[model samples]
Target: MNETISNSPHQWNTQELPVVVIAGYGPSIGESTARQFGSKGYAIACLGRTQNKLLDSVQELKASKITAAAFVTDCGDTRSVKEAIQQVQSHLGRISVIVWNAASYVGSDLVTGNDDPSEILNQIVGVGCAGLLASIQEAYEDLKAMKGTILITGGGLSGYDQNVNQIAVNNSWMGLAFCKSSQRKLAGLLHARLKPDGVMVGTVIISGAVRVGGGLDVTDPDDVATAFWEIHHSRHKQEVHLGSLTQLASEPT
Candidate 1:
């Protein structure tokens, strides 16, 4: 199960280093997020389905002299997620932060009837919402034992109205409701139910498509990474939203 190259350096030289597990390690956000956390002395465990891409991300993070390991993981599968978390714990010692950023979209217009609406909704809920549940469940005990932070990455629709097509296909209304409910429930359970044990659960609602130079501009991967870092460092847990497309003007192309 060790897909990472042996030459990889999997050790950080910091006394109080934070261990972070990023489930959806995409080239854009994953890499940027890892680098940002690494710069702050956090050992990163980059997990994704693509082995090559995961390795590349690990190498890039290692270039900064940060401890990093790449593991092939499928978030939709609970067994796979559980195994990945175990591997991360073995390599990084203890996971202090868990970021669930995995999502799936088939690009079908719910209004046009281009594809099976039920299937698309199932995939989104399964991967976007259910996958997150699996990740958190698998790592919850460890986070609680270590007093870690669980930060879930969300979309604009999770908090606001936009993208009519996405709304229909992903059932944004129901999906967001589920997300909010889960966040509050998780926070209550962790903070209230597990207060004696000491664990924090939080969510970061990322509004708008994350892009450079755009109105209601998407948040920068680095900024999002910083937010994750902050969540990990802070003792309290809370939900926070990024930018608004309606408030900010688009950058001149």
Candidate 2:
């Protein structure tokens, strides 16, 4: 964790404060997630590619007088992720909650007759699983030291085949598998190696499109955010599957 604060309105000086680092802060889920945590009195570190959008979210959080910082980060890049984590550690002290919401879709396909699977797989794995690994690795020590929670955003695309045209259908399948596998591994590692130190690893699986007010079919970013918060604050500390999971498998006991 770095301790150098920049000349930004979002920067706040604090010691031993719990912070929430939102990766892939965007107009929809990212923004909503940041605000959700902000409303909960957690300092926010918004990491994404769009500087202006990140700044806007920071300003929105600041309007409520919440501590927030907009960090330009490319999750796919390890160096960028490391620097972003350092910035959060520096500005907010320590991150208590980490939300892995960064995602990329190359295309969707049935995997039966896909012309090029490499590109799509690379993108999905790069942003979904690999990027997640980088972020987790960078923050592992901090979270472990503070006994924090790592929550990854996911959809019910685990077993369904709705998007047969785009390669994401196949690639996301791999991504989900990788994510679940990684979660299991991280949980095991945390329990064996870091539990004594007090850190927990988990995932929040979102199954369907989030519904908003007026019966309008809006994505429930807030619901997802709430799920993340629940996972962080819950006593059980298990993998949470939100919305619907008729086809998804239950966690092994």
Candidate 3:
């Protein structure tokens, strides 16, 4: 595993690079996080549902010395996640890290007095839990061999704030809230169980909306990326909260 980077952050060159598989990647914090790792000589694999957005992100990262690729992935599906990880390993050498940043924005039919109990269960389990399990299973050997980490992006809606959860309940955002809460729990559980096996698990609770456009200007994407980098660098701690927000998705960035 040899890598070289010039004094310039953009001049990264590597032969055998560890792969950071970012699931649920998008144009905002996901892209920034990719660059943050790319600048550090890690090859990046951005897995998302949108092909065009992933390509755009790849272009942005390639502007530097980073080796990046776009994989159209449905992180909500176990098969898709497994296949994506396989593709990443085949392309980027090995799976060194996983960034779980995807979620379903579907209305909580269960909370809103409608019933899609089965679908909701599948979504929550598939995207945030079972899907992650599949991802880990696919790369577990490599990750354990490399002593890598699983970083989850979660925040206020993880049953942390009664007001936020209540607002989500009121607004039928219970689905996303459920995802956040489950992911928070997942991070803790994985942290405890995987630590002995050389894998680190951590979650960043972004209290503010990601600074992408007109909302949550307080949470800069690069800052969020830095927080992830720092957590990975420290290689300990189960979770960290970033930024400040009075409400969840209500205050308009």
Candidate 4:
């Protein structure tokens, strides 16, 4: 095996670039994260359910002269997640970072409840929790070797759901809050287990509405991506809250 040695930490351009796997590759944080890491010279492997979406992202990354590839898989399925991980390893080498950004938001009314609560919960658990578990399991060895990081996209509703005022204002957000709350807990659990093994696990909680175009308080996906990279680079924070509500002196009780 041949390895490049660098006396200075700043000398990374000469070494083999690390790989970043962006699961649930979409136009929002997924795409931005890919571009952010890719611009830094890391190989990008995008995983998404839609081939067209993945291909478009890959093409855009390639156009920018970044090494990029895409894998199509349903993140909600463990078998599919494993298969995609294997393919990513085969095509892009060991992953140095894993970004879990997939979630199912069916807009199910929590007051009346969905026609099938089981299905909604299943989907939520599958994407928000199960998929993250499977990816970490498959990437553990590689991540441990590289002392890598896992960044999760969390929602503000998770923390806000407990607030009486927030709940009174929008009862429909309960289902999303439940799933996001679970995901945040899962990230914390993973951080506790993996920190000793040199894997950094963190989640960025967006405390306001996220949209392409919105008010000053709305969370921007690009900013969220930058925050993800900053957390990974620092490896010092377990969680970060974005937007007005979270940036306030007191973020929900």
Candidate 5:
């Protein structure tokens, strides 16, 4: 492990601290995951496209007395993703967990059909599959050294297709659904390939809506984050469906 902290946030050799790199740092899952890991003494490397958002998350983490730094990068770009991982490793020591929670679609209008089909497909795949591949490739060595965990955020779309009307189905959403399914498959493949090497890969497939705020709410981001932490520690279960799985199970097919 690289026992060299550039800034040295905690006074001690901060490099000795376990690090977690959140690829898609955001208000929901990303923030919650950071806090969850930070509470457990993990240094956080938050990667996102928006510097302000990244800074906000880092500030909150620091306010909570957690060592954190923000890295600005586009997860959709493989080169950027690789560079971000290298930078994180250089600054924070070896990474113990990396959460790929950066998703592209935000419930916008879907263009199920487009004149430039290839362009749209590339955009979706870049965020979903390509970015993940780049991150995994770059972080594989570091993860292997620490026996790390790779946690992915997934939606209920991967589990089952909803029966909503055609007008309600946005093309972008359909694309996202496809991307979610692809991510799940990729996660399974990664788990199969890396499990033997002691690198745990898992996906937390959320079933319902995620909300902000605190308390004992099951759908709260903080609570959802616990599932992610559990998934990493468990190491045995490759996939965990939170919120929606039971509803899906009870529904008539």
Candidate 6:
């Protein structure tokens, strides 16, 4: 198990802290997840392409008395992702967990076939799958040593029925839908591959709208964060579905 701080936060050592690297650090799920883990004594490593956004999240985390820092990098690029991992280790410590939540997509007009076919496919591949692969390779040593976990964010576009497909097409979310499906499969593959090595891997497939502020939101960011934490501790349940899955009842166990 990764070392946890038993003393005051003021006496914490950054290098001795176990890091939780958020691949697509943002205001929603990422922020919630960071807080959830940080409160548990893990140093948060905010990884994203936008420096301003990363800094904002870092400031908020710091304000909450959580040890956090940002690393700006394009998740789709292997070199950039690997470099960020190196930087996180240098600044924080060994990475004990990774929340892979980066995504990309083409515009509605592009999906309507007005642009290059390859572009649509490229957009679908996005930062989700590739970034995850890079992180696993780069952090394998620390993850195995600490029995770390990887939690992926998936969407409803990859589940349910034609209702889901219709919703995806209506909103021009084809690329995102494809990416989520791919991410789910990637999570499954990693779950089986990493299990023997003591590294748990799982995916939270959100089967509806995710609104951080609640209201009419079908999925809550805090819930996702809680699920991640549960998965980390239990080291079981490779896939967890939210929202729409509640009605399905027959979701694979």
Write down the lDDT of every candidate, Cα atoms only.
0.66, 0.65, 0.77, 0.78, 0.77, 0.79
Candidate 5 lDDT at 170 equals: 30
Question: What's the CA error at residue 37 for candidate 4, in Å?
Answer: 0.6
TM-score of 6: 0.87
Instruction: Give me the overall lDDT of model 4.
Output: 0.78
The alpha-carbon lDDT assigned to residue 11 of candidate 4 equals: 26
lDDT of 5: 0.77
Candidate 5 or 4, higher lDDT: 4
Better of 3 and 4 by TM-score: 3
Q: In model 1, what are the clashing residue pairs, if there are any? A: 216-245
Query: What are the models' TM-scores?
Result: 0.77, 0.76, 0.87, 0.85, 0.85, 0.87
Clashing residue pairs for model 6: none
lDDT, candidate 3, 82-124, per-residue tens: 8888877866677888988888776564645565788777777
Name the weakest run of 10 consecutive residues (lDDT summed) in model 3: 1-10
Give the lDDT of residue 156 in candidate 5: 73
Candidates 5 and 6 compared by TM-score, better number: 6
Mark the regions of model 1 whose C-alpha exceeds 4 Å error after superposition. 1-17, 111-118, 160-196, 212-216, 247-253
On the 0 to 100 scale, the lDDT of residue 211 in model 6 is: 79
Query: Model 2, residue 13: what's the lDDT?
Result: 43
Q: What is the C-alpha RMSD of each candidate to the true structure, in Å?
A: 4.7, 6.0, 5.7, 7.3, 4.8, 6.2
| Candidate 1 lDDT score relative to the true structure | 0.66
Q: Residue 76's C-alpha lDDT in candidate 4?
A: 86
Candidate ordering by TM-score (highest first): 6, 3, 4, 5, 1, 2
Taking the tens digit of each residue's C-alpha lDDT, what string does model 5 give over 181-246? 788899989999998779999888875567886423137788768988998888887887776444
Write one digit per residue (lDDT tens) for candidate 2, span 74-106: 876767788888887766777787888876644
Pick out the ten consecutive residues of candidate 2 with the lowest summed lDDT.
Answer: 163-172
TM-score head-to-head 2 vs 5, winner: 5
Candidate 3 regions exceeding 4 Å error are 1-14, 113-115, 213-217, 247-253
Q: Compare the candidates by lDDT and give the number of the best one.
A: 6
